[model samples]
Target: MRDERSRRAAPHRQAAFDGPGAQAGRGGLSSLTRRIVVFNLVALNLLVLGVLYLGGGRDSPLTQYRERMGVEAALIGNVLEVDPAPLSPGAVAQRLEAITLSPGLELLVLAPDGAVLGRRSGDAGAQAEASRTYVLDALGGFWRVFSGVFLGDGPLPEGQDPLGQARAMMGGLQPGAPLSRIAEGATGRFVTTLMAIAPQDRVLGAVALISPLAPLDAMARARQERALRIFALATLVSTLMSLLLASTIARPLTALATAAEVGGKRDPQRPAPARVRIPDMTARSDEIGRLSGALRGMVAALYERIESNEQFAADVAHEIKNPLASLRSAVGTLRMAKRDDHRATLLEVIEHDVRRLDRLVSDISNASRLDSELVREEEEAFDLLALLRSLTGYLGGQAEKQGIDFMTDLPEGEITLRGLEPRLAQVFVNLITNAMSFCQAGDAIRVWVRRRGARVLVVVEDTGPGIPEEALQKIFARFYSHRPASEFGTHSGLGLAISKQIVEAHGGVIWAENMRATGTDPTEGPLGARFVVGLPV
Candidate 1:
C-alpha cells in the first residue's frame, strides 16, 4: 500500500516549482526572448554611436580648408617681396581694389607703423560679411560641444565676434604670416594670409587676405548628416528583424514548456490528469524542432512504462493470491487432522504450496529487475561461442540426470557479439532449462547457433510435445502458464517474458513456433517446439 501511494506521488514530486518561474504567470516566451532582444538592441546602438563619433569628430573632411589657406598665404608673400618700397598703404589699397579675386576673400590693409590704412568693406569684404556670420554659427556649435569640458559653459564674450578672435590670432601687420581656423561639425572655417607690400629692398605696408570656408564646410556637414540618417534607418530595421527572430524561436519553446508543465503538474491532494497532449513542433528545420521531438518521444515512452508497471503490479497481486490462499487453507486443515495419513497428506500439500510460493516470488523479483539491469549494464563484445560452450558444459550434466539427451550444434569459429554477457547467458539458461523441463526420458534436446547476414540466431529445440496452438500467441505475456495437471505448481511462467524483454532491449528478437516434418498430414501434430533468438552481430 505504501509503494502504491509512492508510485502515484512520483509525478507530484516532479512538478515541484521551487524555481523562480513558479510564482510567475507566463514565463516561457518573455523570459528568454526579452534578454535576446535587449542584448541585440544594445549592441546595435553602440555600433551606430561609435561610427558617428569617429566619422564626425576627428576624421572630418574639412581638413582641405587648411591646405588651401596655406597656398594662399604663400602666394601673397612671394608677390610682396617683388617691390616692397614703392607700395604705400594707399597705393597698395588702390592696386588691391583694381584686382578681381575670390568672392569669399577679404583684404585688411595696414601701414608699416601698424596703423589701419584701408580696412573698410569693399567688393571682397562685402562678399565676406555673410560668410563671417556663418563662421560665428560654427563657433557656437564648438562652444556647445566643449562647454562642459574646457569652458564650463561660462559667460560668452561680450563684444567680440567669434571670427574676429580667430583673425586676431593670425597677428597684425606681420608679413609672411600664415593662419588656419575650423570648427566642429564642419559648420564654418577660414584661413588668413599676411603679406608686406615692398617696391624695393625696404619694409613697406602690409596686406591681409581672409578666405571663407562656408561652401566646403556645408558640403561636409551634409554628407555626415546623410550617413547618420542611413545608419539610423538600418538600425531600426535590424532591431525589428531581431525581435521577429526571437519571437519565432520563443513561440515553439514556450509551447514545449507549457506542455511539459501540464503533464508534470500533480497535486498531493488530488490525482494527476490521465494524459497530457504535447504540441508537435517537428516541422521546423532547426535544433529547436529536434529538441521538441525528442522531448515528446521521451515523455511518451515514460508514460507507457508507467502504465505497464501498474498493470504488472496488478497481475502479480492476482497471481500471488492463489498460492497464499492455498497455504492458509493447508495450515488451517493441519491443526484439525487427527489420523496419521491425513496429517501426512496435509503436510505434503503445505510443503508444495510453500515451494510454489517461493518459486513465484523468486520469478517476480527477477522479472522486476530485468528492465533496470538491461538499461544500466554496459555492453561489450564477447565470444558468443565461448559463452555458450561454458554454459552448455555446466548444464549438460543436469539434463543427463533427468534422462534427457542434450547436444549442441554451435559453429567452430568465434561468433563475436556486443551486449551484456551475463544477461544473454541468463536468457540462454532459461530457454535450455525450459526445454529440459518439458522433455521426457530418451527425448533429445538440441541447442544450435548460426549467423545470417548481420544477425546471429540461437535455437533451443526439444522432442517434447509442442506448445498447444491456443497458447502460442499469449505465451510471452507476464505470468502466463499452460502445462499438464501433473506439472502444475512446478514452474512460474515468467521465463519467456523475461527472455523477450532482454532480447528486445538488445535490439534483437525472440519467437517460438512448432517444428513440423516435411510432407506432414494436415491433421498431424507438431514434431517439437522450436524457440529461436536472433541477435545483431
Candidate 2:
C-alpha cells in the first residue's frame, strides 16, 4: 500500500523529501545559534570560575607578623652591638621572651651552625632549641589540614617542616645576607626573619622570628568556600540563559522546517494538491529570518521547474509523434507506389519529415543543455552598444540577402553591462533571425538600445505583419511557432524560448508586443512586432 501511494504522488514525494537527511546531519539550522550560545557561555563561565577560584584577596597575616619580628630582632641586634656589655644567646632569648608577639609566633636564637641555642615559645632552657622537630610539633591544626587528612588520628610524617626547606634554600641563615623568606608546603605556611647579633663587628649569633600560617589559611579556606558557592550560582544562571537563547533561535527554525516538510509532503488521496503555506519570517531583521525567506523562495522555484519540465516532456512527445507518424506513412506508401512520380513524391515527404524531426530533436537538445551551459560560462563586462553594433554588422548581411533593411539607433555613450556576453549575443541574434523570418523585401528591421536609469533596454522591431494579440504571450513557449506551412520545417520553434532563457539568466527581461504607430489618426496601421530586452547596466 505504501509503495502504491508513493507511485501515485511521486512528484510531491520527491520534492518534499529533498535535503531533509542533510539537514538532520547538520543538526538543524537552529543548532548553529545554539552551539554559538553554548560555546560563549561556557567560555565566559570558565573565565569567571578561574578568577574566583584563584584570586585570594585576603591580606597575609604573616606579613604583619614578620614586621613585628623584624622590629624585635633589630632590638636584640642593637643590644648586642652597643650594650657596652656583650649579650649572649641566653640574654637574647630572655629579651625575646619579654618582647611578646601574636599567639602563633615564636622567637629562636640559633648559633652559626644551625644549632638552636634558645627558643622563646616552648621550654627555653630544655631541648626546644636543639633541632627543627620543635617546629614540627608546632605544625598543630595547619599541619593536619595541609597533610590532606585534616582530622586524622594517625601520626604526622617526620622531617616535613616547610620552614626547614626555606632555611636550606637560604643556606642555613648565615650572616652577611638579608634574612627574610616565606615558605609554604603541605605541612604548613610560615615566614622567617633572621638578624645577626654582631658585637665589635664580629657575628656571634642570629636571632630568628617564625610566624605560623594556621590563622591566615583558615580565613583563606573560608573565603574560597564562599567564592565557590558564588561561582556555582553564576554558572547555573548562565546555563539557564543559554537554554533560553537556544529556544529563541530554535523556535523559528522549527517552524521553517515544518513548513518545508508540509509543502513537500505527498498525499496520494488528494490529487492536484496545492503547496502548503510557508511561514513568512521575513519581518524579522536577522540573518536567520532572511534564510527562512530564501528557502521558501527556492522551494517555490523548484516546484515551478518541476511543473515546467513535466509540461515540456508532454509537449516533446506530442511534437515528435506527429513527424514519426508521417514518416511511417510515407515509407509505407513509397513501397507500394511503383510509378516514378508517385515514389518521388513519397521520397520528398519522407525527407521533409526527417528534416522536421531533426530540427525538433536539435532544438530540444539545446534546450536541455542550456541550463548547464549557462552555469559553466563566466560573466564579463562588455560595452552593450558595441555588442549590439557588432551583432547588427554580422546579422545585417544576412538580413540584406532577404532585401530587408537592418538599422540600429544606439546611444552615443557606450553602456557597459556585466553578463555572459556570448549568451546575451545569442539572444539578440535569435531575435534578429526571428524578425528576418517574418519580414519581406521592403519591410525594415530596427535594433535600437537606450539607457533607462539603472536599466538598459534593447528593442528589436520589424516592419512585418504584427503578432496577433492572442499569440504574443505564447510565442516564447517551447515548440510554439506561428509560420506559413511552406516555412514550417525550415524554422524550429525553440528560438524565442531559448532567447527568453538566455535573457533571464543574465537577470534581464524579454517581452513581445505589436507596435502601434503613435500619430494623429487614432486607427493608424500597426507598425510591426516589438521585442524588448531589458538588462541591468
Candidate 3:
C-alpha cells in the first residue's frame, strides 16, 4: 500500500525542466570564478597602461633638451667665477640672458644666502622670480597629469605648488632629494629635482630644477584614455560572455523546472521525455562539468524509481489474486454443504479464509490509497484538547472490555490546529487501537495533548512490552506486523502506515519512542511505545 501511494502520487509526465542535466547548464555562468576572472583582466590592463605612461616617454628629445639646458647653465656659472678676468654680476647676468634667447630655458643663479647672484633678465630680481615661477608651473603641470590619470578630473588645488605638495607629502626633502612628477592640469606634467652644489659633501645652496610637463602630461593623458577604452571594451566583452554563459547554463535548469511542473500532472501512459543534455565541457574540468554529471545521475535515478514502482504494483496484484479466488470458492462450497455438523465445520473454515481475505484486501487497498486518500482535504480550526477528550471517551469502552486502564492527561484550554478533522481522527484511532491491542489487564493507556511552538502534539502512550529497534521502521510498512497474526487475530496491518501517511499529508510528522515511567520507585524498564503526532496550529 505504501508503494502504491507513492506510485499514484508520482507525476504522470516527465518534468519539463526536471532533469539535473538541464539545470547544470543554467546556473554555471553566474558563478564567482567567472566574475573574478573578468575583474582581474580589467585591472591588469589598467595597471599595464599606467606603467607605460610613467616610463615610456621619458626618453623623448624634449626631455633631453631640458637636461642639456640645465648643464649649460651650470657650466656658464662656473666660467663666470673664473679668476683674473671674471665678469661682474651684471655682465654675467647679461651673458646668461643671451643664451636663454634661443628657446625653452629660463635661467637664474642664486647666491649662497638665497640672494639673486645673477640672472638672464633684470626685472627687480626677475630671473630668480622667473625660475621660481617655472618651478611652480612645472609642479602644477605634473599634478594635473597625475590627478587626471588617477582621479579622472581637473588639476590639484591651486595656490599650493604641485612640487611643494609632493615635497611635503614625502616628508620635507634633503639635498639631492629624488626628482618627482606631479600634474598641473589636464594639459601638463611637472618634473622636479633638487640640484645641490657641494664641496666635500658639505652642501651649498640647492637649485630646484623645474621643467614644464606639457609633453609627459599629454602622453599620460593619452595612456589613461587608452586604458579606459581597453577597460570598457574588456568589460563589454566579459559581460557578453557572462550573459551567453548564464543563458547556456540557466536554459537547461529552466527547462528542467518546467518539465518537473508538467510532470506533476503527466499521464503515465506516455513515456517520460528524454532528458536535455548539457553541452560537454569535458575539455575543461570545472563546476559546470561536475554539475552536468550530477544532473545525468539524477535523471537516471528518477527513471529507475519509476520503473521499480511499476513492477511493484504488478507484483502486489499477482500476490493477492490467488488468495481472493480461494476465499470466494471456499464460501461457495460452505453454502452448499448439506450435513449440519459438516456444514458448521466448513463454515468455520470459510470464516477463517474470509477473515484472511478481508485483511489482505483491506491492507492492499489502504496501502494503494495511502498517499492520495490520506492527503488532508478540508482543514478547519478545532481544539486538540476537545478532540482528545472525545477520542478517549469513544475508545474508553474498548479499553475497558480488554481490562486495560484508559486514561487521559489533556491540558486545559483549547489547543487549536488547522487540519482535516476526519484525518486527524483516523490517526488518533490507529494509535489508540494499537496501544489497546498490546495493553494487558490493569495496564494503562495514556492519551495527552500539549502545545509546542506553532504545533500541537498529541501523544498516545501505553504500558506494554516495548517495540524492538529492528522492527521500528518496518512497523509502518504495509502488511508488516510485529506480532504473529494468530496472537492478535486477523488484522489489516495497514493501520500504522495509514496513520503515518495521514500525518505527513497534513504537513505533520509522527514518530514513536520507548520511555521509562518517571518518578517510579525504581525507574521501570521501557514500557509500551509512545507515538507523538505533531500538527501545525
CA lDDT of each prediction against the hidden true structure: 0.73, 0.73, 0.62
RMSD of each: 7.2, 8.7, 14.5
Better of 1 and 2 by TM-score: 1
List candidate 2 stretches off by more than 4 Å. Answer: 1-84, 88-100, 108-155, 159-171, 174-191, 199-201, 234-303, 325-350, 411-416, 519-524
Cα lDDT tens digits, model 2, 455-503, are 9899999999888877977899877889987786776689999999998
TM-score of each: 0.73, 0.70, 0.46
Residue 122, model 3: Cα distance from true site in angstroms = 30
| Model 3 C-alpha lDDT per residue in residues 1-537, reported as the tens digit of each score | 556656765664342232343333343444444665576567766776776666558675446655654565345434444332423467545655544332332334443444444544223222221112333455579998998899799545554453343334333334433333344533344544434333344444333344555543454455556655666677777677766665655454454444445445546686964444333333346665566456545655666556545655665665566566766776788778788898888777667767777777767776676555544355678877787788899898889988999888888777777777877888899999889878889999989877889887889899888788778777776556777545543665668877887888788899988866677643455767899998887
- Runs with alpha carbons beyond 4 Å of true place in candidate 3: 1-315, 318-322, 325-340, 355-359, 373-381, 452-456, 464-470, 483-489, 513-527, 535-537
User: Roughly what TM-score does model 2 have, to 2 decimal places?
Assistant: 0.70
Output the lDDT of residue 366, model 1: 90
